[model samples]
Target: MTLSDASSERTRVYVLQSRQPLTTDPAHAFPADRYDVVVVTDGTAQEVLREDVQAGPVTVVRAARDEWDSVVTSMPPDAVEIVTNDEYCVAACARLRDVVGLPRRHPTNVDGYLDKVVMKCHLAAAGVPVPQAVALDPVVVAARDTAERAVSTLGLPVVAKPRREANSRGVEMLEDAGAVQAWLARHDGEPGWELEAFVSGDLGHVNAIVRDGRVEPVQAGRYLGPLLGVGEGRALGGWTVPAGSEWAARAHALNRAVVDVLGTDGDFVVHTEFVARPDGRLVVLETAARAPGAGVSELALVHAGVQLEIANLRLQAGLPVPVPEPSGRQACWLWLPVPPGRRWDAARDGARAAELGVDVRVRQVGREGNDGASAAVGASVVLVNDAPGGLARTVDAVLNEPWFRAHAV
Candidate 1:
């Protein structure tokens, strides 16, 4: 059908964006011929929209995060779809669906995905293996007692995490009762904290597309190290598990169980992380109702033909999701956080990456320090190879290089 012929019958889709999409051309995700698309983003995102998209049929509207409710309520009620891939905006999008009189397209227990304490409770109730967690209210005078109680219950070396934050923003590891006490005292009177027993196992994640409660597993991979290690100057990276591998099957099954327990009544992309214990048991660490960060979605695009973020957008817009086919190439991605007061020297990093003699795609190069945000990406690298262990070995070689430090200004 011609673009003009389909315009009159197009479904109105409103995409809520908090950051620039990983897709080079987001407009292509929602074809102008089939969907009338409007992107609702903040003022900061205006400049990032590509020029062609700005001149196309898709419309752009500026609405700050805090002002989303007002902006959503004022939107024309005829809008058929509301979509967002941002972690911070998931709950808001769920609530806004009601204001527009649209049928609930998100999980009924949406809070379970937003709050760690609530999420663990739901998963535990469903007989899913999750870490034993104790919720903590901010305490002032009784901080020591509170810390001692948590340690006594959950054991020593607990992980203290903000219940609602994402990207490991306020996560801390307390090795002893005294450390927990000190950590608690520092954040006195702050709310929404929880303590869970630290699970020592291989960290891995699975990304999938869910439609009508059926999960189509996309890709599963093992992390080089814990995400928390990134703050200690460790380079975070992971390699995709080859199709039909034992780890892939186990990860996919665990991901399926998580979706079933989490109430998968709607269509969306689910990002799940789990710890594979040495004894062959998989314990879900946490799950999100949106696309994952750290170039994972892009890695999926490389390993499989499906880009999860784009699939997420298409699902929300009532468009058909593309089936993923293995590309016969294993993919690995790395993120190097620029240290404080240092800038990313893309030229030098590119030069170093070329020495590895593999396909190294530099996805992003941050020119300024990332300010210690665990979620920030100072530089990103993607490597794909057809050999069985080529990607993993190249990832190791990339990590061993002093690229970030050697190019220090």
Candidate 2:
């Protein structure tokens, strides 16, 4: 095999660690013998130099969290690929990749993927369906009259959110004109507030791998309940829509459209959320270039046969991406939010959640002594079960059981 051959030649890979670790092991796709792996972490040395990084002949570099660009710029020119599963790190990774002349999404276009305001604008311009939206200028949003004028076009029950945050952070649905005014008053000084019409429909999502304009179905799921109506500190859980169905195809197509509009130079992982109207129309909510967080990647591996971490790395390495077919197995996942000021026995609770079914897989739970924990604060459970309906029922039962809420007070 010549050095020009992609499959035969060894590749040097650089992986940047997000606040959370990779969903699947890096070695799954790139065997140690075929790849030289270097892991860079923003975390403390003690935190990142753990079992996984030590398990292989891998080098760990500890850098200040904000110095990712500098770290990448200084890498040996021979380093062939750079990738990160972190959504927030996409821009810096793109910048570094561009600097090294690596094939990936252009750094100039990442804002359209990360920022909701810019994202909707691009989608709309591309003739993709998106909820009506307006970015509230800071000065106008602070004034009652101007704020009302800014939001008038979006109509009542508008959704307000920060332009750049994810996992629905700073996302809220305002019911009426008064609610809109109150939301503006609460977020008075904060800039980058975007208001959109609250589309009424079932919230659905599609995760897939797109290479050269082809999309492979990862998993299509629908939210079991109203996401924003639950208010703060609420965990959103849902079941995967049965694969190989009409609805699933629409979701996949919508995801593909998002990728086409965003325009990536090579294969990329897409996590797109959309709303499915009762009239059978699918409207895109937003899309991200990185793998979906909160164990959705695990769900895809279990039910859809796609290893996202591997696919992402493979694409970055310029290797041919193998699309995985859906297994037709029903699956469900949940991000259980742990309330603040309470200690949790992660092991015991995880076991109880597991006992819900034989196919249950509980990825993680918050351990004791961790207070003020919420989903955003890194306290949550990532559970997937074979029984689609059973997963939600079991989770609800466990959450409601008085004994289940044992506080380490």
Give the top-scoring candidate (lDDT). 1
* Highest TM-score against the true fold, candidate: 1
Worst ten in a row by lDDT for model 1:
46-55
C-alpha TM-scores of all predictions: 0.85, 0.80
Q: Kindly list the per-residue Cα lDDT of model 1 for residues 1-409, writing each as its tens digit.
A: 1113234666666778665443334666777666766678774554434221224444677877777777666646664667777776687788887777776667888887778888888888889899988887553334667877888899979998888877787889989888888887787777788889998899999989888778888999999888876655677888799978999999998888888877787778899999998898889888998878766877889888888887886676556777777787788877776554455566776676677654333323355444443434466667788887777777777777776452344
TM-score of model 2 (CA atoms) = 0.80
Error of 1 at 79 (Å): 4.7
In angstroms, give how far residue 363 of model 1 lies from its true place.
8.9
Q: Distance (Å) between predicted and true CA of 257, model 2?
A: 2.7
Candidate 2: clashing residue pairs, number: 0
Q: Cα deviation of 23 in candidate 2 (Å)?
A: 3.5
